[model samples]
Target: MFRLAALFLALSPATAFACGQPVCLVDPDSLSLTKIITFEGERAGAGPGHNIDDVLPLQGATFGEHFAGQSVGARGPHDEVSGDAFAPLTMMAGRAGQNLSLVHFSGNTVLNGYGSAGFPKRDAQGEGAIAVLFDQDQSALAFDLRGGEDGAALVHFYRRDGSFIGPVPVQPTGEFAVAFLRSDGHADIAGFVLTNTDPQGLALDSLRFGKPPDMS
Candidate 1:
């Protein structure tokens, strides 16, 4: 019986798990979502600007664009961006809403195993972290991330009232990787913070939020 159990465990797919916490699935496509933010559209300035607060409260299936033309050094903090209240999806810098930058990538830039033109980068002060708030409460969340050459990052879950839940580490080979986290039980996932240690910088794109297929 012991050997049979061990064999079953070995044959099972690897997953990041913890007691009373969410599970990190290896594939983002495993979860079906109703909406996705691609971050592609118009901008206020010719180059990367600071304190981008114009685009928010996105309506319908409309896709939001990032600020363009700013130099890499001039990238500043981003204001809170969100979808409609019905299916609320908001993204900020820190838990307390600190400032972060939205970067425009040109040339050969790839994230989550695919080419990316622009996306939000981690805040330098926050130590490569971005906080996301889900007003509607979600059972699952997924996004594309690009860590430094070393490739290391984590997803910290939280409740609606700003209570800590648990964390899942994401270590993908190469520069681009995708991360997906789904609650083990109900739709209690209120928010999550993604952090990376890449000194070269961290990038995020293609954020998806919705109920998991397996959940009732």
Candidate 2:
């Protein structure tokens, strides 16, 4: 306990994720949420401006196997997805895997095997993409969105139990929440964020979740 406290103290106030900032949100149903982790280029040691569209099975990432508890998973061009530390959370195995639950896309999209430092700007490419995260069971759940400078980034949601949510709009910043899984069971989901109105539509940071109802 002392060592952990000391580590926290030793960390700079600017330390990513630990800065105690609230995550941005986009849920009209008022889904409860807490920021379980924050993306930091320094911790990942990959620094700022890393490639958000790298191919799956990325090598030498800072997030080894998982972040918080949910493993990192993203779908790429070849019907393949990779997770943190090169784990293939591919869709060929029924969009379910030992490390992943399901994958989705509104268009040809990919998930970031590891998190990055910034959100998208006004002219970024890559449209119609979303991310979903969870464990083998329904215990863990969540995903990410890249904020934009134009209008609110709205998305059409698909839930784990094959339900739908949204036309939800996430503001450029501050504690956004939406549901993809069952509200009471597993919040599994795949969402189709509309095509970027601006160039930098959805460049994202590490979308964090998992831990439990209290976000502990």
Candidate 3:
């Protein structure tokens, strides 16, 4: 029975991801981020899966740090066989059932709601904000996002002083798309702010950054 359970877990991408203790490595005042990618979980299932409480945020794992206060409050790992009805991102069809799955994201990292357990991908609120405080100064940041065609999502950058910088408008493409952002004045990065206007915010994933000048 134990072997069967293990096999079931292995063969299915709907298994919850294991959460551990890995302190923040990126020093907000040190190395800069260059580039980021999409999270397909290696096409593990039929859609994108995120492990709530994943300690590693640098490599795509994200928790509700900004809202949860002290690195807690994840939606629990999600490895269900859900369908990706989003048009722009239908490419993520799961591999097992031959349905589109986001099995292979740019890397294995992703935001499990980044700042809260509430998944904002389907949020219908007119406006909302989510933030993530980094251990390192992020001079620049970028990520892959998808949203409803009518809604608009903006990625905001903040400095160490907790001052808001500029907002990069994420065009509603209704599909998985990449958005790049740099400090308006080449300031060091402290936190990332994602705001949704109109219908709701988009689904954000992966991340790459370094110096503001180096646009990877």
Candidate 4:
């Protein structure tokens, strides 16, 4: 018997997800949702000129067989352009002696990884990508987002049981926010967001989610 845990961290301008592998869910419209696990908030201009940044958890989901899906995000063709988004929503198997490596996303552009060491607009050809990586034993998870100034980037941590640990802070903090996980032992989900609205900084508002209950 497999277990499923679905979580979505979202904003009016951002959205995200996470899962085990094989199966997954989607909630692209999170700005106008109303529910107990969901709330509303906004930022001046921290998103991609229009979209917000979000994280999610796909339950009972598999990538192949042996390994479960840990994280997902957009990959880029260059370190400047945004790539298509993907995540591990179900459980997938890994090679006999190998682990799941190299999460990928593509579309108009192709991207592999993400970082804040340098600006994609002024540095590398292909921009970096955001991702959630599950540890080897699948006991814990980590979030990584790049493109901010200085070393003050964005990161997060969580327990396999779907408990919130808190946001990971970087130096010289730029803009940032936080979201929570919503699960019901099913294979669907909705996003919840808490944003920061400080000038050239991060602001967090109330918690929010979607309507009609999507998780199964």
Across 76-112, the per-residue lDDT of candidate 3 in tens digits comes to 2212121112211111111122111122234443332
lDDT of 4 by residue, 1-216 (tens): 111212233321122224332112233232233432111121212222212122222231111211132332222222121221124322222222111112222111111122222222222211332333232212111112222343333333333443333343345543232233323223133111111111122222222333334556
In lDDT terms, which candidate is top?
1
TM-score: model 3 vs. ground truth: 0.45
In angstroms, how far off is 192's CA in candidate 2?
Answer: 6.8
Tens digit of lDDT per residue, candidate 1, span 110-187?
A: 221101212222344223345565546776666666445564566666565555567777664234546455535456
Q: Residue 3's C-alpha lDDT in candidate 4?
A: 16
Tell me the lDDT of candidate 3.
0.37
- Runs of candidate 4 exceeding 4 Å displacement: 1-129, 135-151, 173-216
Candidate 2, 1-216: lDDT as tens digits: 775555333322233224232222323222323443334322121112233332122211122222221232333211112222122222211121211111122321223222121123112233223333233223222444443455344443333333343334455522233333232233333322222233333443434443224424
Question: CA lDDT, every prediction?
Answer: 0.44, 0.30, 0.37, 0.25
Model 4 TM: 0.22
Clashes (backbone N, CA, C under 3 Å), per candidate, total: 7, 18, 45, 61
Order of all candidates by lDDT, from best down to worst? 1, 3, 2, 4
Q: Cα RMSD (Å) between model 2 and the true structure?
A: 13.9
- Candidate 2 local distance difference test against the native: 0.30
Candidate 3 lDDT at 45 equals: 28
Which is the better candidate, 3 or 4, if ranked by lDDT?
Answer: 3
Error of 4 at 38 (Å): 38
